[model samples]
Target: MITIEGVDAGYGRLQILFSVSMKARSGEITAILGPNGSGKSTLLKTIFGQTSVYNGSIKLDGVELSGRPPHEIARLGIAYLPQINNLFTDLTVRENLLMSGYMLSEEERRKRTEEVFQLFPFLRNMLHRKAASLSGGERQMLSIGMALMRRPKVIMLDEPTANLSPKMVNTVLDVVRRLRDDHGFTVLLAEQSVVKALRLSDHAVLLVGGRVLFEGDPSELLNNKELGRMYLGLGGG
Candidate 1:
């Protein structure tokens, strides 16, 4: 399990997260839900070591990861996919996957690439196509495929579905679910589509102004009429 305890982090001198604490249990999807500017992305960045932590601890299993650099953290089986700039737009689909697995041996890289291709079969046909030429959904898939190349134990995604079509959104969500069900990856994602995210996630954390308002089963947030409508903008089902 990935544990965050009393984590205070931000960029430069600007603090965004305040004593934040949460747990992303193994083999489950932990959805980070919040409004705009609520520090949702910053929390993910902190976990990935993109932002500095002023206090507290971040651990994977029993290993402390707070002061470690991003690459070091990634080597510890944690992979982070930022909301944008996650893909090498100028590179071919296959090249992007190869770049992500540079640390592996040549045979291992080839083997992992084939494994990710199995997860995203459409990418198999687009191996030679430049990433910039793909549609929004296709680009998202390629970005995820790159992360999967690492064979990470925990996958963190910042808005895997931001501006895709409804069909593409479902496709992305399905892939997220399969990553856990089929591959046994621990998934943590900051999502904008609250209703869809809640439905897909095993647990949810509601953040407002950098503080956690709720953390438990997604249904608790969805079932709370006042909190849902006021904070989450969720309507009655």
Candidate 2:
């Protein structure tokens, strides 16, 4: 449902992504795996309009999105949950959820908040608590829950499992899988943890030096020792 073609994006006068192209299909969990500085996050930002796309095009459901603002992208059913600084730490859990739906009407906001709470019941009990007081895992859950408050068609998560405990990581991945299987939401996840990401994804894209090194089912990556060792530093054997 999302297509990025030959996208080049970077900070002012400094390019990070170079002609990267990929597609995330509806009803699939596509994982973007790469080592640090591989321009994986840049690809997401360029698609979401957070970075300027100097060349090529990003299309959501067949409409071009190159010059649109980030909020416009959001309104088109794309939600981006970045690796860090996604929420207002000082805001209460309920307040944060409320903020995510500010673009919707009051009745729509309440409806969406209930839907998010259904996905993450733990947040329901902590509605009055400050976001900063929650544990790291809880914070991450909150971030994802807030993104769900928008009722997006495509949810793009950048390193959702990053800094959580092992159990928490499993919890987050379980939620993501359920989001795809049960809720039918299209998921595009960018992660550095190849093994965990592959375990949860339906498809994989390997990126290096701001380009698509490989793109296919996870088995292609998990079965290739040479590719894994060369790009990801994992012995794959």
Candidate 3:
């Protein structure tokens, strides 16, 4: 499991996350829900070592991760996909996947690429196409495929469904579910779609002003009339 306890982190001296504590359990989806500036992305970045951590601890299965660099954190089987700039826009889909696993042997890289293709069959057909040419949903698919190439135990996705059609949103969220349910991968999703994300999530963390306002069962958050309507944009039922 990925555990965070009293983690204060941000870019340089600017502190965004204030004593953030949470757990992303294995084989389950943990939805990081919040308003636009609620620090959802910061929490994910803090865990991935992108931001400076001032206090507390971040541990993956009991190993300290706060002081480690991003590459070192990634080598620990954690793949973090930020909201933007996740893909090499100039590179072909196949090339991006190859780049993700360059440290592996040639044969192993090919094998892993095939595994990613099996999970996302459409990627094989679009291997020659540049990532810049693909749609939002397609880019997300390619991004996830590239992450899978490295075989990560934990996947942190920052709005995987951003800027996509409604249908594409569902499609991407389904794949996120599969990563947890079928592949037994731990997923920490920071999403903009509140209802869809909560419905699919096993656990929910509601962040407001860089603090944990709520954290627990998804159902509880869904049923919260005040919070749902006030901040989450969920209509009264």
Candidate 4:
């Protein structure tokens, strides 16, 4: 559903992604796995129009997204969730969700909220609570739920498991998998958690120094300890 070719992006004169090319199929989870500062996040930001792309093309369902603004790209069915500072901590959970549906009608907003509530049932009880008081897991759930308000065809998540408990991480991964399997949402997840990301993904891309080192089925990385260690920065099986 999405295709990127020779994409390069960075701040000012410092380029972070180097001729990075990749693709995400519809209704499948495609993971971008790499160590810190490998430009995985920049690739996502470029696709979402958060970062400037000096060169190459990012096509979503055959339309070029390179020069489009973020909102315009969003209207084209792309949703991005960055790693940190994802939610409004002072607002109530319901209010935060309402913000995502600003473009929808009142009835549509309520219906979408109900749909999101089904994904994170924990929010159903805490609708009135301020986001600041919610646990890390709950905050992540809120962030994801907000993104889903528009029912995007493509979703990009950056380091979703960062700073979360193991149990919460599992819960979040389960939701990601369910989105692909049950809802036909295309997923592009950039994560530092190699093992878990690979386990949940239908395909994986390994990046090092802003370059794609490997792109293939997840089992290829999982079954080969040496390749995982060398390319993914893992030391052992």
lDDT tens digits, residue span 34-140, model 3 = 88999999999889888899999999999999999999999998999999999999999888998998999999999999988888999989989999999999999
Model 1, residue pairs in steric clash: none
lDDT of 4 by residue, 126-156 (tens): 9999999998888888999999999999999
lDDT of 4: 0.89
**Steric clashes per prediction:** 0, 0, 0, 0
Tens digit of lDDT per residue, candidate 1, span 16-97? 9998999999999999999999999999999999998999999999899999999999999999999999999999998899
Once model 4 is optimally superposed onto the true structure by TM-score, how far is the C-alpha of residue 235 displaced, in angstroms? Answer: 4.6
Can you give the TM-score per candidate against the true fold?
0.98, 0.96, 0.98, 0.96
lDDT of 2 by residue, 1-237 (tens): 988888888877788888888888998999998889998888888878888678998898899998999989988999999989999999999999888888889998888888888889888899999999999889988999999888889999999888888898898899999999989999999987678888888888898888898888888888888888898777745
Question: Given candidate 3, what's the lDDT at residue 207?
Answer: 93
Give the lowest summed-lDDT range of ten residues in model 3.
227-236
Worst 10 residues of 1 by lDDT: 228-237
**Displacement of the residue 85 alpha carbon in candidate 3, Å:** 0.7
Candidate 1: give its CA RMSD in angstroms.
Answer: 0.9
Between prediction 1 and prediction 2, the one with superior lDDT is: 1
Better of 3 and 4 by TM-score: 3
